[model samples]
Target: MEPEAKWNGSTEQVEFSRMSPRSQGFTKLPGQKTCEKSVLLFTFVLLISVVLWGTLLFLFLTRFKKIAQDVEKLQESCVYHNDSGIVTIIRRLQVDQWDLKNDVPQLSKAVNKLQEDQTTLKSKASQISQQVDRLQEDGTTFRSQVLNEKNTATQALEKLQEEIEKLWTEFQRANGSVCKNCPKDWQLFQKKCYFFGNEPKTWPQAKFACINLQGRLVSIKNKEEQAFLTQKANKKGSWIGLRDLDMEGEFIWMDGSPLNYSNWSPGEPNNQGQGEDCVAMRANNGRWNDAFCRGQQEGWICEKLATC
Candidate 1:
């Protein structure tokens, strides 16, 4: 039997497996609305434009805010640097005033001592000159008489030179060659006792003066040694065992060991010289610098070998 049809519905059934029908019939097919179509297209374009504008605005705002923050950070950094610069200047000026106040008296005393030494040497040299004049007269007289006598006098002249050297050594020993009964603050170590009082000195002058006392400056090797020095230091500032670098511009101890200190001041041993050659401890106990040998005061330090 064939399929039955119902009221208000189509009864025909169509099947097209591999072909198209020439005509089709339905209750009614809904037509596409042209006004609605135009309205949908316009809405899509409006949404796209809005989305594009919003994305661009968001990106622009983000970049502008980041740039503004960077500018503010740069201003803060500049301000911090300015404050630090001012602080450093103030500290330096105060140090300068303190140095001048203390250095004047100490320098005057040193000058006086040097002047006395010069006077004594002058007197001694004058005496030697007079002796030379007399000897020359005697030599002239002897040479006229006997060549053998002048030969004997040469030995006598050598003896006199030796005696003069011995006397000079003895004089140095009496004055500062030995640290006898030094104060507790300036305790002697290995025949060298230091005074950590006032101003920096070139390594050469410090070493040379110390050697005159039959001693050298105390050599610092480690942390303990540096601590001992710091303890004995006078807050007034003084010379320590550090010095100008050797030929290769490498820092070394007086005994020629590599120099490494336990305590150092801020930015120490910068050797700010166009080409530095000397170092001295600054008024601030732990500070140091490389400087010209002559421009600054040759600070005083007395060194004397210990009595065995």
Candidate 2:
């Protein structure tokens, strides 16, 4: 029994130690209530924070989109204003250019009127210049004609003076030195008488024959010359004053001057082609006639005036 009692005592001691509450209280008593409350509070705060952050982010995104739309509308209004202002400026400039073009026709008409007046003045000036040239030519011709007339008048006056002096000397010579021993075949001029019938020849041969006698052919210049020579010839058919040997059919005297008045027989100087080369005077009519040079039926007479 003693031995059984000891083993039982050891087993009771082991079980009593296991069944005591003091060991369990000591392990759980330090951390059990505080840990449970802290877990619960941290879970509630995480849920509230998530809800507030999500609401604020949604509001911010919505306001940003509205502000961007307002900016787009304002830019569109500004573009329309700029386009309308440019169109108004271009239309006003076109209206001003059209007004300037309307005045060009009046300027062109004014220029044309000035040109027409200039042309008319030039035509009148040309006509006036032509008239002035014609008047100058006429004045030159009139001056030349007046100079020629003055020279002719002076020559005529000197000729008249010489004839008056000759008549005075001739009257003094008449019957003062009368030729008592003169020949019958000689005629007197101033104080000298000449004989011309030394030979019968043609006009050329007669000229040479007269030069040998220191004489020339007869020359009559005035009406007193006709009476003086007729009375001196003593009624003979003699070769006398006028002929046409120098200019054909233009009768001239021996002094190389033309005859203003001629003493010719009627129907004389027929110039018949059969040697009508000699000049003869008619006895009764006291006029000249053309005769044959070979005919010896007519003779010649001559006279000479003093040069002094």
Highest lDDT scorer: 2
How many clashing pairs per prediction, in order?
3, 0
Q: Residue by residue across 1-308, what tens digits does model 1's lDDT show?
A: 23344321342332332334433323233444667788899999999999999999999999999999999999898778876797688789889989988899999999999999999999999999999999999988877768656745753664465456446656777776742444454566543455443445555666666555444555565676456565665444545445554463566555444676535567755656555555554553535566555544435344333332
For each candidate, give its TM-score against the true structure. Answer: 0.33, 0.35
Question: For model 1, what is the error of residue 169's alpha carbon versus the real structure, in angstroms, after optimal superposition?
Answer: 23
Task: Please give the distance, in angstroms, between residue 126's alpha carbon in candidate 2 and its true position after superposition.
Answer: 72
Worst lDDT 10-window in candidate 2: 177-186
Per-candidate alpha-carbon RMSD to the true structure: 34.9, 29.4
Candidate 1, residue 294: how far the Cα is off, in Å: 2.6
lDDT of 1: 0.60
lDDT of 2 by residue, 261-296 (tens): 667788988877855755776675668778765564
Q: By TM-score, who's the top model here? A: 2
Please give the TM-score that candidate 1 achieves against the real structure. 0.33
Candidate 2: global Cα-lDDT?
A: 0.64
Give the whole-model CA lDDT for all candidates, comma-separated.
0.60, 0.64
